[model samples]
Target: MNDNNKDDKTLNHSRRQFFKISTALTAVALTPSYILKAADDNMDDKIAELFEKRDLNIEVNGIVHTLSIEPRVTLLDLLREQLKLTGSKKGCDHGQCGACTVHVNGQRVLSCLSLAIMQDGKKITTIEGLAKGDELHPMQAAFIKHDGFQCGYCTPGQIMSAVACVREGHANNEDEIRSYMAGNICRCGAYPNIVDAITEVKQKGGTI
Candidate 1:
């Protein structure tokens, strides 16, 4: 009788082990298909995304550049990251501060808001391009002479907008200069000096 009892216990243990193994196999087989693909195929998708760039041809400062870049890349990133032009500041990248200002096709634009992919065959001018060899642009010289910048982080944008303001013939008076240059924000309260610089340049009346 004791032998039969021991045999019954052994049979029950074998059945339990079999059921546990079967349950585990069934669970694995029933896993969602998307989960399986995410574990293995998603990595390949990310790798492919890294190479997903389109051809871009644009001019910077004065030199033409042909590059392949992702469509999401902004003009500011293309200049600062790829072309190594760091003069354009990235303050308030929401197009409010105007720090990332640059000339796009002879018009002032916020680089942070402009996409690199859409600027094909366009001319872009940054703060670094505002000067000749060993000579400053008239606006730049006036800014220096009048002390237009205090912290200097907003200087580039200010100068770009100032040039545009003068070019647009909106720098006729102090009020108009302030109104036209209102897009740029200088934290150091250098408005008077900036107005002076723009006024001086406008009075000179030469090509900026």
Candidate 2:
């Protein structure tokens, strides 16, 4: 082939390859949308088939929460999604981190690990319910005063555990407080401040 003719042919091949790659990329991007739409449609049908309207009577904070919750809903999901109380965070859904800690019948329990049905007719106190009108709980106040949190992702759990620790008389000393709160991990390494908050609350005779 002539040199000019060969160069022209190479340019044409490159243009065709570029178009082919562009088309492939477009299809690849659309594939995820199509799959997501199909999955959403399937979920809608399953929800309609499985979900039955029923009343769920449970006490949240101090008031009775009467609403319908799916049988498969976890207590943590119910609290955050259904009730719109997102104070109890979902750190470790497997009950490892105490982020989803809340008072169930006056005892600290991992809300993520509990079923909504199991907490029926029991008193539930979330972090939102800890404060009284405008006054924060002693632990919450201590947390703020001592700057017990860095990222604040683990602060809620730390505060909740601190409340329980004091109420259960586990915060008799710094070492005991640390040992008791060892279950609730803080990625920010705010253990000293957390222990200080717990100690302050304990000194004041605070109860959850």
- Among these predictions, the greatest lDDT belongs to 1
- Candidate 1 — number of clashing residue pairs? 0
Q: Give the alpha-carbon lDDT of every model.
A: 0.86, 0.79
Among the numbered candidates, top TM-score falls to 1
Model 1, poorest ten-residue lDDT window?
42-51
RMSD values, in order shown: 19.0, 18.3
Runs of candidate 1 with Cα error greater than 4 angstroms are 1-51
Q: Write the per-residue lDDT of candidate 2 for residues 1-208, one digit (tens) a residue.
A: 5785566557555654554435434434555565445444544333232333334679998889866565778999999998999988999899999899888898888999898977778999888888899999888888999999999988777887788888888889999998999879898899999888888888887345
Q: After superposition, how far is residue 100 of candidate 2 from its true place, in Å?
A: 0.4
Q: Can you list the residue pairs that collide in candidate 1?
A: none
